[model samples]
Target: MPPDSDGVPNKTRRDFLKKSSFLTAAAFVPVTVVNAAVNQWDEKLASVFEKTSLHLEVNGLALNLSVEPRTTLLDLLREQLNLTGTKKGCDRGQCGACTVHADGMRINSCLSLAVTNEGKKITTIEGLSKGQELHPMQEAFIKHDGFQCGYCTPGQIMSAVALIKEGHAGSEMEIREYMSGNICRCGAYPNIVNAIQEVKTGGLS
Candidate 1:
């Protein structure tokens, strides 16, 4: 910038930068407007074809649901079927608090697509009881105090039940390794393992 007669700069770099920023923002205004408009159009188009139907057995009850194809199994269970036992920890499948049994196998319900669960038997924590009688795993957890906050208890019990049914609950190390996916943030792992071991080895004492 040219200096004035007083030997002072007429305009500093900060002033130039402010002007340049305004010009740059003005130039990008049209692009921003167009992008927002296109996004709105894309969202509308995507929502248009999202409606879909799925049939699955949840908690021993047959359910035929009409939902968006993008709906996850967790949402289907919690939002649609009112089964809130499955907690949503990390929706990206990193956490296993949303674990459930599908077709007798444990899977992260958050990552499972509702549309793909058709004709599959889905078992949640709510299904692990007969009337008022608790399942063996449930009883074991209660007896052993397997959980502290109890947020992860449902998924843990679900996974443990499936493992017991599959005869995978042999050794303590084996149970820990198998149950690694279901994390207990409260560090109640020892007691949780003890509960599963008791239910598996017929030694609840």
Candidate 2:
């Protein structure tokens, strides 16, 4: 009954007793009820929320898509658009196997959220060719045997194209430094570098 600093009756013991009683009651609740409540809450959220609409162009095709906010560009391309040439190697942006071009700049699609790329242009490996005519970089890679196992070819090609566009393919050292993000486990670094050099020198605009 004693008043505390807030000029209210001290209810510490009362609060503790109330909490204890509630907890004791909760302890007797069946696990099924708790699980059902959680499931119902999740279902309600899903039913109430709407998927985000993303307007973007991929491989010269304008796409209007509905996706969850959590969807990544990699998933949008590979899972939804069926552009599986962009390999999901590490999926952490470390191996660079999921690399793609967003608005003419190289990016790790795996780490880039699809919602963030709304209204942007995306280019995957599948976009690099026109009918039977391959992009110069793609041709160079094939000629140079730039990949073995071929898991990282897509990312390596994308990065290489961007490297030449960015004017970073001046030398072998520079190419290696810039293209270091794309890792090839097949020990084809030399061939990869050669392919990039050929493309750079070939003047492919």
Candidate 3:
């Protein structure tokens, strides 16, 4: 900036910075308008991801919901249905933390799509017990100290119950083979096996 008639610079550094900032901001869309555009775009994206109708019984409670095709049964349980007892670990089928029962069959909820189990009966950890009483398998797990960190306990119990019902708990090796899907990081395998044996032998009521 050159000196003006009065010997002062035409614009001080502070004045130049203020004007430059204003010009820079003015070159873009106004914040309010940009925010509105972003919101509209989000709505369009959501509409593009069409939601399918889901009707099923979870934990004995009948529910009808709208979910996206990509929505997993684990997400449907924990997120929308508020069934947090089924843990979401690994997100992939590798971890059995998201185990649940669909129409009497144990399934890795994370690997199963919500829309694929329409009109099915789902059972979660929360569905095991009656009021003020724990299920036999749940009780057995606790009695046998089947869990340490306990993150894998729910899946363990669910799988154990199904294992007994499926007649796969005939021996120690059978139990391990059927429960190979569930990985317990805390190394509670021995205790878990004991609990399943007890339940299979009709040891716990």
Q: Write down the TM-score of every candidate.
A: 0.76, 0.79, 0.80
- For model 1, what is the error of residue 21's alpha carbon versus the real structure, in angstroms, after optimal superposition? 39
> Model 2 reaches what TM-score against the true structure?
0.79
1-205 per-residue lDDT for model 3 (tens digits): 2236897754445445544544554577688446545565434443344566789998888999888878899998999889999999999999899999999999999999999998999999999999879999989998999999999889989989899999999999999999999999999999999999998888887
Off by over 4 Å in 1: 1-49, 203-205
Q: Sort the candidates on lDDT, descending order.
A: 3, 2, 1
Global lDDT scores for all candidate models: 0.82, 0.85, 0.86
Please give the lDDT score for candidate 2. Answer: 0.85
Q: Give residue 131's lDDT in candidate 3 (0 to 100).
A: 85
lDDT score, candidate 1, position 197? 89
The lDDT of model 3 is 0.86
lDDT (10s digit) by residue, model 1, range 1-205: 2236997754445445544544554577777546645565434544444456678998888887787877899999999889999999989877689999999899999999898887899999998788998888899999999999999999999988888887878888989888898989999999999999888777642
Candidate 2 per-residue C-alpha lDDT over 72-173 given as tens digits, one digit per residue, 9 for 90 to 100: 999989999999999998889899999999999999999998999989999999999999999999888888899889999999999999999999999999
Which of candidates 1 and 3 reaches a greater lDDT?
A: 3
lDDT, residue 87, model 2: 95
- Runs in model 2 lying further than 4 Å from the true structure: 1-41, 44-48, 203-205
